[model samples]
Target: MIDINSWPLYVQLAFGLGPFVIGFSGGGILVFTTLRHYDRIVSSFPNSRGVQNVLRIFANYGFHPRSMQVAAIAGIVLFPRMCIRRGELEPEEVRNFPPEIKRLMVIFTTLLGVGLAWVALAVVLLKLSGGN
Candidate 1:
């Protein structure tokens, strides 16, 4: 272990907060993009349970912007296969997906993975240090 306890206070603070910062920033951008592009995306994933449920929830919420954003991010990121894979997502739709949406998906997934990994590392560091 790298002995995170021995690190400077500022450095420790940075490590503690970095994942949250990335999660919030990336989440905000992803939500906004999803909000802006929901129409373009919804049609493509008609059979995806995650997408359908989220959209239903988003609709039942009276089309609230924040709800829609949360729905889109959760729908797309959590069940990526529902939107990307051949059996889960329609082949034609996947093939015809817009470039911008693809880029957004990549960015969203990467940000989520990075944020989770960062938090996992922090936990592992602490565990290895015997909660010191």
Candidate 2:
């Protein structure tokens, strides 16, 4: 059990924000990917409007903003153990995603950083203003 109180302020702040960052990263990818492949994703589901609506709702909120945070925590706990037991990824294995997908990833990463900073600034301003 690490002593958080003994840690520097920056480290304490990072510990607080780390989950937000991870969740945002995951949520950003989910949002960008879903929007980019909206047609293809929707087409794969049933043609019924009712089913489609349900799926749409799920797609919109299933990977909602904080979902990525949960996923990040799960991955932190599960991925490393899986990797150690299964061995590392092969050197020859590579993701040959389409150019558009690559572009979306780059765009989303930039947007996520900007968004996080913006949100942080807004929160600080709100607090400074005493929630007025």
Candidate 3:
């Protein structure tokens, strides 16, 4: 197998730092957007059973409902920007998203971003450790 130690220090640092940066920054954006969207929904429909059900599901997954709610809102706010950057979505699509579904999307995207960052960090650390 090829020796990772032979690689330059910049490469190693990039491998180490890239994921953490993406995870923390991207995750923060997602969490912020999701919470804002949730607040909007709650304000508009205080008696929304659907919202309660959604929160219940998040709680079942071992998340604090309030924190998850905020993350969900952040994710919603960040997704359009992400999708546009990736060329997977257009500005028009953002305008067409229903408020409730937008909140759900945020939650999904935030979790996905966090998971990706964790995985990237793991790979980088493994490489740095010379584990192959």
Which residue pairs does candidate 2 place in steric collision? 23-68, 23-69
Question: What overall lDDT goes with each candidate model?
Answer: 0.68, 0.46, 0.55
TM-score of 2: 0.37
Instruction: Select the stronger candidate by lDDT from 2 and 3.
Output: 3
Top TM-score prediction, candidate number:
1
Candidate 1 vs candidate 3, TM-score winner? 1
lDDT of 2 by residue, 15-54 (tens): 5576477557756775767555544433433333432334
lDDT top scorer: 1
lDDT of 3 at 110: 57
Which parts of model 3 have CA positions greater than 4 angstroms off?
Answer: 43-50, 57-64, 70-132
lDDT tens readout by residue for model 1, 1-132: 567789999999999999988877677667766667767777766665555666666565344654455446544654566456534445555556677777776776677679899999999998887775
In order of appearance, the predictions have TM-scores of 0.70, 0.37, 0.49
Indicate whether candidate 1 or candidate 3 has the larger lDDT.
1
